[model samples]
Target: MARWQDIEKDAPEFAERVRARFGAGIHKTIATLRKDGSPRISGSELEFEDGEVKFGMMDRSLKLLDVRRDPRIAVHSPSLDPPKEAGEWLGDAKLAGRVVEIPPAPDSPHQDAGHFRIDITEVVLTYVGNPADHLVIESWHEGTGWRRRTRE
Candidate 1:
């Protein structure tokens, strides 16, 4: 686990890229464990605020049930395809995090709903440029923001 400061000094440009790639009307895949210990998957918009990602669901949604049963969850943002030429963005990233449900607000759109936050724990970066096949992993934990876990 690496603190936010441990990673390359806040790469605003890179952060912007990430936000643009994953944030633009993109849907995130959320996976949680069911009461029976099975995996339940759902897709929802990835909302970013104060550096954290959030998802909202109706109380009747299976996702809310799953999260209530198990807080551990994983989220993935699909790969963005760029121009087939060099100088274009050519990589994909996935985020794995822990989910924490937020209490619904009475006047909120989710008032009859539930909200879950995905606290990013790890990130996987895969490069698809040229020869492709390059990958990198970054892990985060308490007291740590993000740290390189592997490079290949």
Candidate 2:
């Protein structure tokens, strides 16, 4: 797994685009594993701080419990319908990782909440190709490094 800074250092432009997409909306989606190993989708918000991806959950929330038991997590950026022109679409960003809890500071506003950071396994950004005639998928993985794929 890699830290957000590692991604940025490796691919500054791609990392910036992903961050911008995630920042485009306030509410993102997070997937956590339930006790039964089923996937649980929940609304979540995250921040890029101190070169790390961090998020919080309400105290004792189901999502929090889920992560505590199983740290694997996936986060999807907020979405908007594609424009009439596919070329105008901003596409989507996603990240999968493991959550590591951090102790809240004594005066932290989230002291009553659960604070955590992600050790990213991968980061993906999909968008329309330059001509907007094909789909472009770019990704970065911890061990494999960066790769790009396009589909007509």
TM-scores for all predictions: 0.70, 0.96
Q: What local distance difference test score does each model get? A: 0.60, 0.95
Task: Summarize candidate 1's per-residue lDDT along 31-128 as a digit string, tens digits.
Answer: 77888998888887767664656678777888888777777777766545666663355455566657777765467865777776665556554444
Question: Model 1: runs farther than 4 Å from truth?
Answer: 1-15, 86-89, 129-152
Residue 64 Cα positional deviation in candidate 2, in Å, after optimal superposition = 0.6
Q: Candidate 1: deviation at residue 67, Å? A: 0.5
| TM-score for candidate 1, residues paired by index | 0.70
For model 2, the stretches where C-alpha displacement exceeds 4 angstroms are none
Pairs with steric clashes in candidate 1: 2-144, 2-145, 3-144, 3-145, 4-145
lDDT, candidate 2, residue 46? 96
RMSD of each: 4.0, 1.0
Clash list (residue pairs), candidate 2: none
lDDT of 2 by residue, 15-106 (tens): 99999999999999999999999999999999999999999999989999999999999999999889988898989999999999998868
